[model samples]
Each structure stands twice: as structure tokens, then as C-alpha cells.
Target: METAQLQREIREFAVSAGIDKIGFTTADPFLEMKNRLRRQQESGFQSGFEKGTPDERTDPSMLMDRPESIIAIAVAYPSKMDNPPKGKKGGRRGMFCRASWGQDYHDVLREKLALLESFILERCPGARLKSMVDTGELVDRAVAERAGIGWSGKNCSIITPEFGSYVYLGEMITNIPFAPDEPIEDGCGDCTLCLDICPTGALIEGGRLNAQRCIAFLTQTKGSLPEEFRTEIGNRVYGCDTCQTICPKNKGRHNRFHAAFEPEPELAKPLLTPLLSLSNREFKERFGHMSGSWRGKNPIQRNAIYALGHFREEAAVPELVRILREDARPYMRGAAAYALGKIASDEAITALGHAETAETDAEALEEIRAAIRNIEDMQKEVPK
Candidate 1:
């Protein structure tokens, strides 16, 4: 069978398989991306989670033998949840970003890619195919953009015309030289909303990002979050969607077709206090299936503590006090101490004072002292 005819059949198969968008591109090295990544690395703008060296990441041929063309696929996820849980003053809740609202996208996309690989192999015997999802060495965004899946939005997301930036992307490299699709033109004309609205200003003047300052990246780190980004982090437990949600292109584009990507409000926006007490086993049993749980419960619990502090939820003071007193993890204890200070009730202040006296970890003790100082300052500002 001819490659073009096969490509047409594959496109139909992809759409039938529930892939929202599909495009094809040559397996040529992404020279521009390589240079940009090198610059990003030099400027210390990269998120350390990125896999592979620049060369391997840019050159697709190096990843698969005789890679002649690449197939990029996008699966749209729901941008909005029906009957979303509300977070109030007393019953504060932390949010998982839209990306992590449902089951892990890695598994979802991988299943689709696996099916696509099987279809290709049956059609073309001896066809060489290597499939990859988000964790792949090659950049999904660049490949998708080059394959005409979507234009790269100013927010650094591949914005599809049909689904906006609310889509999961994956790709397959095949030895067959399928005809390539035309790349889309830039559509972000004069729209700086995503840049101006980024909580930590991670978006650069161009379409680049300073990943270190990004709240999305910081939320995944397993340590005491830097003090500066804490307030901006707000109630987000994992990932962020500020830029995507604010994009003009994404206005009114909410695709909730896939049941696999559907969110359970209780899990997506769980109460902050309950999160503080979840044992590892409980955490996995509850949230293990969600993509946001990839970094484990430590970061989520730590962020939940910060979220309670951000809201100054007085009801959470007891839980914060308990964590400050007895939590084994120093980061959790320290974060709870900070949260208690933010709450600023007499009980919270008293707990911080007690924790300060008994705290042996120097870092946690510092957090306690800082909380005490802040609370004292807050009290001083009020009229007697």
C-alpha cells in the first residue's frame, strides 16, 4: 500500500480511536529547539525534570532507527468541571490543576499510542515504530507544533484550533516517509494576557519560560518552597492553568468527551486539613491515579498547608498545630508552622511558640521563629 494512502487510513483510525487531532512531520532534527534549549540551560531557566541531553532531545533520528516521519497526536481534556467543589474560609480546599484533574494522562495517551502502533504494524509489516508520551526524549510541543497540531501559544502550550491549549500530546516515530502537514501560523497577535497574568512571571518577553520561578514547577519540588513564590502559589496543589485559562484562544473551548479524563470534585479539590493527615498508604489509595500524585503526597500536603495559610482558614489551625507538633517530616512541620502564623489566631500563635521551644530541626525552628515574628507584627498593626 502507498504511504499517503496509509497515512489517510491512519488519520481516520486516529479520529475513530478518539484522538482529537493528528498531524505528521518529517523526522528532521529540531535545530531551533536545540539552540533554544541550550540557551535555556545556560540561563538556568530549565526545569530540572527534563530528560535527555540537548542533542538527543532535538534529533529524532538518534532515538529511532531510520526514522523517516513523525506522527503527533493530541487528546483534549475537560477545561471545566461540573458541580466543582467550593473552598470556603473555614473549609479550605487546595486544587489540583486542570491537567491533573483526571486519571494520569501518561497512561491515557500511551494506550492510544499503543493502539496506533498496532494499527501501523498490521498495515505495514516490518514497520519500525517508536511511541512516546510526555516522558519521551523528543519535545512533544515542538513536534506537535511542527506537525501542524497547533501553534505554540505565548504561554508555551500547543494551542489547537479545536480544543485550545487543553489537550494532551504524544507522538510516534515511524520509518515510513508519510507526507508532512503544514505548520500553523502564530495566532497570539499582541495578546500578552498569559504573560502578564502568570503568578510568578515565569513567561518571558518572547514565548520562553523561566521554569524555576514558575509556581507549577515549584509546587512539584519536595522541599520547603521558596518564601517568595508561596503567596503566589495560592491553593494550587499541583500544576497550574492560569495562563491557559486566561488565553483568548481558549475562551469557551471546554472538551469533556473522555470519561477517563473526568474529575471527581472531592479528589480534585479536597479539604486542606484532611490532606495533612494522609499516610502514604492512604494518599496512594486516594490520589495515586491522578497525574498530580506523580511527585507523591509530600509536595501536595506541603502545598495544602500553604493553601490553608494563604486562605488564613482558622478552622485548619488545629490540624496545623498538630502537624507542627508531631509531623515527622521537617518540611511538613515547618510548612505547618508557617501556615499557623498565617492563620494568626491565639491557638496558632500559642502552638508556634510551643513548637519553637521544642523544635530540634534548625530549618523548622527558623520557620517557627519567622511565623512568630510575622504574627507579632500582624498583631502590632491592629488597634488594641
Candidate 2:
């Protein structure tokens, strides 16, 4: 089969298979991305979650033998939920970012990529192909940008003209030399909104992110969240979407093209209090399907404690106190202490004092002490 004709057939098949956008690029080494990644490494800007080393990540040849072309696909997800539940005092909710709204994109995109792979194999029986979603070695955004699926935005997301930045990216590498698509022109001209509006100042200029400071990354961590980011994380239980939400390019792009990506409001924005005591089994049964639940219950529950604290929700004091006094996990107990301090009620103070006496873990005990001091300082500031 002619490569151009094969590419045309693949494009049509992709559209029919529910791929929102598709583009092709040569399987050249991503030299610029390699250099930028090296700089990020030197600066300690990378989130430890990244899958591959810079060399392995930027070179397609490293991943596949004699890669000739890369196929990039984008699936648009909903940016806005329908009649989303609102967070309130007693029933305050914590959010999972839009990317984590529905089913895991890894599963959804992999299914689509599988279909694409089978289609290619049917047409050209000897075609050697490898496909990957976000977890793959090659950078999804870089592949998407080079393939004309989108331009890499100031917020470090691929900003598609049609779907804005609300898209999940995936790619396929093949030995067949499909005609490469022209790259999209950079569209985020003079946009500083994402940088300015980031609560934790994680966005360093345009197209650069300090992942250590990023709320999205912090929310996934297993340890007690750093004190500096506690308040800035607000009510986010999973990833942060400040940069995406603040971008002008993403303003009206609520692309709900894929049904699998449509959010369940209750799951996406869950009540904060109930999350405190979920057993591992309960957590998996309730939230396992969502991408946000990948790090398991600990991080989500910890972030929930932070959200309750951020809201200063007096209603959550009892639950937070229970966790501080009784939860076996030191991190949970520590997080609960911090939340109780933020609530700073008479009941919370009494609970903290009691927990401080019984707390055995050194770190948790220190957290209890710090929380008591914080409450005392706040009380001193009150003009009686």
C-alpha cells in the first residue's frame, strides 16, 4: 500500500474510532526536548513521577528499531461538569482535576490506540508498531506539537485549536514512513494568566514548571504535604487545574467529545469528610476507576484533610480529631493535627492536647506540638 494512501485510510479510521484529532511526525530524536529535560534535571524541576530518562524519552529510535514515523492522537475531555456540586461549610467537597474526571485516560486512549494499531496491521501485515499513552517513554505533548495536533502552550500543555488544552495525548511509532504533518504555530502569545494565577507559583515563566512546587504533583505525594503548600492547595483532592482554568485559550473549550471522559459529579467533587475514614477496600470500590485514585487512598485522604483545613470547616473537626487520635498512619495523624489546628475550635484544641499526650510517632508527635503552638498563637492574636 502507498504510504500516503495508507495514512489517509488511517486518518479516516481514527475519526471513525472516536479519536478527536490525529497527526503524523517523523520519528526524529526530540533534541530540543532532551536539552530542556537536562536543564530541568539540573534545576531539580522534574516531578519524580516522570517515567523515562531524558535520552530514552526524547529518542524514538531507543524505543523502537528503525522508527520511521510517529502518529499522534488527541482525545478531548470535558472541562466543565454539568450542574457541578458546590462546596459548602458542613459538606465541603474536594476536587479531582478535569483530566481525572471520568475513566482513566490511559485506559481510554490505550483502547483507541489498540484499535488504530489493529487497523494499521490489517492494511500492512508486516508493519512494526508500538503505541503509548501518557506513561510511555516519548513525551505526549512534544509528539502532539510536532504532529500538528496542537501547539505546546505557556502552561506546559498541548493547546489544540479546536479543543483548547482540554485534551489527552497519545502516540504510536511505526516503521512505515507516513508523510509528516507540519507543526502548529505557537498560539500562546503574551499569555501570562496561567503563570500569574498559579496559587503556588509553580509555573516558572512560559512552558516551564517547577513540578516540586506544583499542587498537582504535591497532591499525589505519599508524605505529609509541605506546610508551605497546605493553604495553596485549597480543596483539590487530586490534580490542580489552575493553569488550565486560567488560560484564555481554554476559556470556552469544554470539549465533551468522548463519553468515557464525562465526569460523575459526586465522584469528581467528593464530600471531604467521608474521605477521612475510608478503608483501603472502600477507597478502591468507590474511587478505583478514576485516574486520580492511582496513588491510592492515602494521598487523597491526606489532601482531603488539607481541604477541610483550608475551608476551616468546623463540622469536620470531629472527624479530623478522630483521625489524629486513632489513625495508625503517622502521615494521616499528622495531617489531621494540621487540619484541627486550622479549625482551631475549643473542641479541636482539646482533642489536640489529648492526642499530644498519647501520640508515639516522633514526626506525628512533633506535628501535634506544632499544631498546638499554632492554635495558641492564633488565640493570642484574638483581641479579647
Q: What TM-score, over all chains together, does every model reach? A: 0.99, 0.99
How far is 365's C-alpha from truth in model 2 (Å)? 1.2
- Worst 10-residue lDDT window for candidate 1 reads 85-94
Tens-digit lDDT track of model 1 for 1-384: 899899999999998898999999999999999999999999999999998999989899789887999999999999888998887878888888989988899999999999999999998998999999989899999999999999998999999888999999999999999999999999999989999999998998658999999888999999899899899999999989999999989999989889999999999889888998899999999999999999899999999999999999999888888889888899889999889889999999889888988999999999999999999899899999
Q: For each candidate, what is the lDDT?
A: 0.92, 0.93
lDDT of 2 by residue, 229-275 (tens): 99998999999888998888888898978888899999999999999
Summed backbone clashes in each candidate are 0, 0
lDDT of 1 at 320: 88
RMSD of each: 0.8, 0.8
Model 1 stretches with alpha carbons more than 4 Å out: none
- Cα lDDT of candidate 2 equals 0.93
Winner by lDDT: 2
Clashing pairs in 1: none
